[model samples]
Target chain A: MPLLDWARTQWDRALGALAVLIGAILLLVGWMKISDTGFVSEQLPYLASAGLGGVFLLGLGGMLWLSADLRDQWRELRGIRARLDATADLAE
Target chain B: MGILLGMARLHRKAGAAVCAVLGLAIVPLISADAQADATYAAVAEATGTRVILTNQSIPLNVAPQLQGPTASAVQNSLQQSDAYAAFPYPGEEVAGIPGVVGGAAGVPLPAYPFVIATSFGDGAKQLSYPGIELRAESTETLTQSTATGGSTGAGGTSSARVARDGDDVVAKAVTDLDALRIGESLVISGLHAVATASRDSAGKLTRASELSFTRLSAPGFVIGLTNGKFTLQNGTEAPAQNDVPLAQIAAALSGAGYPTTFQVPQETPDGIIGAGLQIQTTLPAPPAGTPGGFSGETPVTYTIGLLRAEVAYTVLPTTPAAADTGVDAGVDAATGVPGAPALPTTDLAGLPGTVPVLAPVAAPVAGIDLASLQASRAAVGSDVGWIYLMVAAVGLAAVGGCAVLYRGAR
Candidate 1:
C-alpha cells in the first residue's frame, strides 16, 4: 500500500512521523538563521528554542511510535494466550 | 528465523548510522555567508591557480592583503608623492625623494605661488591659498582568499595630508597603517612618503629635496610602490583631471591679490618626465616598449600611477571600530580609491556586521574569535526565555501524544 494510505489506517504512527518531520524542518531553519549570525549571543536563542524544541518533538514522536509497536506486540501475545487456554480446555 | 531477525536488526543500526552521518554533513551547507559569497566572487574574478580547499584536515594559508578604499587611497596618495619626488630640479637629481620612505616635493611648474595637490582617486580634494588645508583618510578590508583561507584579516588604513607653510610645501602619504595578520604568513608591505622643502625669506630656492624612506621585507617577492615605480599588471589607470594650475588660482585670488613670489621648477628637464602620471601598459608586453618592467598574471590588470608622494591624512576610518558607529559612516568611508571601494556591511541583507562562517564540522568558525563572541554575547544580553518556553511546550505535547498512543493501543 502507498505510505499515505497505510498511514490513514495507522493514524497513530502517521502523527508521530508528521511531528518528527515538522521538528526536523524547524531545526534546519534555526540552523540556517544561526549560520548567518556572527555572535554566539545571536545564535544562542535559535539553539535554545528551535534546537531544543526540535529535539523535544523528536523524542515525543519516537515515544509515540514505540508505544504503537508495543501495542501490536501485546495484541499478538493476547491472541496466543487465548489459543493456549482453548487447547487447555479441550485437553481437560 | 532468529538469524534473519538478527540480520535485520543489524541492517537497521547501519541505516541509522548512515542517516546520522548525513545529518552532520548538512551543517556545512548552511554555513555560507555573504562575505564568503563576495570572496568567492573575487577569486572567480581573479586569474591564477585555482585553490580548492577540499581536504578539511589541511588548512589553506595565505598572507592577508589589503582590500577596499584604505589601501587604494594610500596608493593614490603615494602615487602623487612619486610625481613630486620625480619632479626634475635643474641642478640636482631628485634622488631618494620618491622611494619607500621619502616624500614627493615641488609644486608643478605651472602652478607657481599656489601649490596644487593632485590625486586621482574617488572624490576631488582641493586646497585654496591663505589657509590651504586638505586631508583624506580611508579604511579597506585586508581580504585574503577568504573562500579558501576561510577568514578575513583586520583592515588597513591609508591617509593623505597636504598643507602649505609660507615658502615651504609639505605632502605626505602613508599606507598600510595599523595592518594586522590573521594567519601564519606575515607579509606586510607598508609605504611612507614625506616631502618637505624650505626656502630662505629672500625667495631664492635654498633647499628643495628633503626625503626619507623606510622598507620592511618579508621572505618572498613583494609588489607595491618600489623605488617610485608602480608596477601595473592587468589593470588600467584613470586619466588625471581637475588640476588647479597657478593661473586658475591667480584668477580666483585676483580680487584678494596675495602678492607672493614662487619659483617654478624648470618646465622640461632632461630625461623621461611622466612623473605624477599613472599608466596602464598592455599585458604580457614591456611597458612603453621598455623591456622587463612589469610582472603579473595574465588577465589581471593593475593601474600604475607615475606620481609618488607620502601624505598621511585619514578621510574615513572604516575599521571594525569605526564601522560599529552606523552603516552610513562605513559606506561614506569609501571616499578614496577609484576602482577599489570599501565593502559596506549594510549590503549583507540585515546580517550581523561580520557573517563569520561556522567551523566546518570539527574546525573553529573561520573569522569569529572566542573573546569577541563572549563580548558580543555579554553586550547583547539575548533573551533565551523563548527557548525554555518552547522546550516545556514540546515536553507537554510529547506526554499528551504518549497518552493518546497508549489508549489507542489498549
Candidate 2:
C-alpha cells in the first residue's frame, strides 16, 4: 500500500519530466531542419508551427510539475463530495 | 490512483488539441512553400539570351522662317507702290509677279519668289524658297523697372538706380504657308533693321528703340514611309537625305513637334532668325475592305507630301558567331581589328622588320553559363527553408506556453 501511494504521488512529476524532454527534442529537430535547409521567409510558417508546438509542450510540462499537489487536493475534494452525497441519501 | 489517472487523461486531451491546431496551421505553410519553389524555377528558366528589334517611322514637319529689317523694307515698298494699288494686300496670288516701286529708281519686289538660295558642299545642288510674309497679327509691349548698379533691398540712399525699358512683340501670319521638305535650305533676304539708343543727362543708357523688317524662311522636313514599295515624283529622283525606318519616323512625329528655329552661322548674311513650322496630320479612316478595316488585304496607299525618300530596315537576330564579333566582344584575334591592343615592335639591326610578332588574345566567353545560375537557384532555395524553420521555432514556443497555462488552470 505504501509503494502504491508513493507511485501515485510521483506520477504527475514523471509525466511533466517526459513532456519537457519531448519538447526539447522537438526544438532540436526543428533547428536542425532549418539549418540544413537554409533560412528564408518561405519556410517561416512551418518553422513557426513547430516552434509553437514545442512551446505548448514546455508549458504543459511546467504546469504538470507545478500542480502535482493540486491533483491530490482535487482527489480529496471528490472524495468529500461522495461522502456528503451518501449522508444526504441516508437522511432522505 | 484514480485522481492520477484523471490528470493523465486531461493531459492527453490537451496535447491532442494542441497537435490539431498546429497541424491545421502548417497546412497552408506547406502549400506556400510549394508555390514559392515553382516561381523560383520559372525565374531560373527566364534567365537567357533575348533579342528585340524595333522599327519606327518618324514624321517631321518643319517650316523655318527668316524675319528681320530687310523683310519689312520689301513689304513697305510693295504696299506703298501705286502699281499694286488695285489689290490692297499682295500674297500668294501675286507671289511670283514682280511689282515696280516709284520714288528712288524703280525697285522690283517679287512677293512670293525666294530671295535667297543655299548650296551645300561643292554647290552642285541648291534649295530655294520664298520667305514667309508676316503681317502684324498682334503686338504687345511691356515695360518694367530693372535694378542697375545697386544691391537689392540695400536701402542705401547713395545707390544709383536706373529705369530700364524693354519691348516684346509676338506676331502671327495671316495665312498658312506651304510645307518645306527636308534637304531644302532657303534664305529670306532683304530684311533691314535700324536701332537707336538714348541716354540720360548723366550719359547713362535709358531707352532703346528698334525697327525691323520681317522676312520668314520656313524650315523643310521630309517623312518617308515605306512598307515594301515606294513611288517617286515624276521629274525628280531621291534627294540626298538620311534614310530611317518608318516606325522611327512616326515616333518622331508623335513626340514634340519640330524645333522653332534652325541654327544658322553668325557670319551668314541673314544673321540670327526665328523660324517655326506647324505640322497637321490628316489621316482619314481606312476604307471598307482594307486590312485594318472590317476585311480585305490590299495594301492601302498613304500620300504624305514633303518626303525626300522612303526606306525600310530588316532586322535579324545575331547568331552565336555573329554575336561574338560584336562591339561587346573583345578584339578579333585574326584581323587584329576592333578593340585590339597595339604593342611596340622591336627592330633588330635596324633593317626591314621580320614577321610581326603578335600579342596573345584571350578566348571570348560564350553565352551565360548554367552552373553559376544553378548555384544562385540553390542559394535562394536554402534561404526559404531557413525561414520556415525559424517560424516553426517561434510558433512551437508560443503554443507550449499556452498549453502549460491551460493545464495549470485545470
Candidate 3:
C-alpha cells in the first residue's frame, strides 16, 4: 500500500510536468499560426516584440494549467499516503 | 534508452537547422546583388563574340571577267572544237526560244572548258556572290595535224576534211578562206559511234549521214559550310555573345553540361529579337548502371525582330542553255532562287555565280545570353533545394520530440 502511494505521488508529479510542457507547446504553436507573413515584413524589431508577447502569454497559460493539475494530483497523493500510513500504524 | 539522448540532440539540431536555413536564404539575396549585373554582361559579351565570329568570313563568289582579246579568242576556240555543233552565236539556241533570243545547243564540256582558258580576265571586278564554286573539274585539249595545202585536200570545202582517221578527229583551223592551219589532234575516246549510209533519191553516194552528239556530265558544284550564320530580317544576328561583358558564355554553358541548343532573345538597336539555343537530347532508360542507345539533333534558335539566326547553306551549278551545254540546270532550286543572269554559252551560267540563298534560319533569338541566364536560374533552383532540406530538418525534429517523450515516460 505504501508502495502504491509512492507510485501515485511520482505519477502525479510527472503528469503535472507533462501537462505544463504540452500546454506550453500548444500555445507556442497557436501563436505562431496567427503571426502570418506580416510579422516578417515589418522587420526584426517588430517581430521580436511580437514574439515576446506571444511567448509570455503562452507560457503563462501553460504554467497556469500545469499548476492546477499539480494541485489536484498532490491532494489525491496526500490522501493516499495518509490512508496508507494509518493502515501501517494499525498493522504495527 | 539511448534514443532519448539522440532525441535531445536531434531536437537541438532541428532548431539550429531552421536557423541555418534562414541564414542560407540570405545567400541568394546576397549573391543576386553581387552577381546579377556581371551575369547579364557575360551573356551579352558571349553573344557578340558569336556574331562577330560568324560574320567575319570572306564571302565566296565567282567573279568572271574576259577582255576583248580573250572573248574573241574564246569564240574562235569554240568554233574550232569539232565536238560542238555550230551556231551563229555562242548563246543563240538552235531550236530558238519563242521570244528570248539568247542560248544555244549544248556541247557538254566544249563550252564549259572555256572557264579553263578564260575565267577571270582583264577589266573585270567583283561578282556579288551567293557563294564560291567548288573546284573538282576538267579541261579541254586541242588536237589536229597540218596537211600541206590542207586548205584544198580532198573536199571543196577546206581540204583539211579527210574520209576517216580511225577514232582520232582533227580540228582544221580556217585562219581565213584560203589559208588553213592544222590544230592538234583530239583522240575521241569513249564516244558512241553511229553510221548511216545516206541514199539520195537513188541511194547512191548521197553521202554518209554525219552528225553526232556526245554525252557529257561534270562533277556537281559544292558549297562550303564554313562559319555558317543565321541572319535575321532586321539585319542583326541574334544572341550576340558579348552583349555586354561576359565573354565565353557559350563555352561556359557547354562546360555546364547543357545541351548545345539554346535560344536567347536579343534587344537590338531596332527592337527586341528573341533568340535561344536548343539542345535536343535522347535519353533511354536501360538496366541499372547502364546507358541506353540514344540519338539526338540539337540546334540553337535566335529570333531578332523579324529575322531568326541559325546555320544554313545551299549548293548548285549553273544550268546549260542546251542539254549538251554541260551546265547543271537544277541543283538548289529549293533554298530560294538567286537572281542570276544567264551566260551566253558557258556552264558559267549565272552572273552571281551563286545559288539563290535564303538561309533564313529557323531560330529566333531569345532575350540574352541563354547559358548564363540559365546558370543563374539554376542557382534559384538550388536555393529551393535547400528549403527542402530545411523541411527535412523539421521532420527530424518532430521524430526527435516523439522519441524524447517516449523515453521520459519510460
DockQ of each: 0.07, 0.07, 0.01
CAPRI rating of model 1: incorrect
DockQ for candidate 1, please give it: 0.07
Report lDDT (Cα) of residue B193, candidate 2.
19
TM-score of chain B of each: 0.20, 0.19, 0.14
lDDT of 3 by residue, B1-410 (tens): 35434644543454344335434543443332110100001000001001101111123421111110001111101111111111111122212242233234333222322111111122121111122111111112222111111123211110111111211112121211121111111111111111111111111111111111121111221111111222111222222332221223333333443223322333222112222223212223334443332223222121111111110011112212123322222322343222111111111113242211123221111222333433443443312223323332343344334334434543
lDDT of 2 by residue, B72-152 (tens): 100000011000000111222232345433223477454433322111111111122232221111011111111111122
Q: Pick the candidate with the highest lDDT.
A: 1
Q: Model 2 interface RMSD, in angstroms?
A: 21.0
Q: Could you give candidate 1's per-residue lDDT for residues B1-410 as a string of tens digits?
A: 35534633543453344335435534443343211100000000010011112122223431111121111122211112101111011111212223323334443332222222223232343333332222222212111111111112333222323332321223333322223221133222232322222111121122121111122122232223333333321122221233335343333322232211111211111001111211111224324534433323222111111111221111123223223222121121233311211221111122332112111111110111323322332343322333433453454455445545544654
Q: Which is the leading candidate under TM-score? A: 1
TM-score for predicted model 3 compared with the true structure: 0.16
Candidate 2 lDDT (Cα, whole model)? 0.29
Q: Give the number of the best model, judged by DockQ.
A: 1
User: Which portions of model 1 miss their true places by more than 4 Å?
Assistant: A39-45, B1-410
Ranking by TM-score: 1, 2, 3
Q: What is the TM-score of each candidate against the true structure?
A: 0.26, 0.21, 0.16
Tell me the deviation in Å of residue B405 in model 1.
Answer: 18
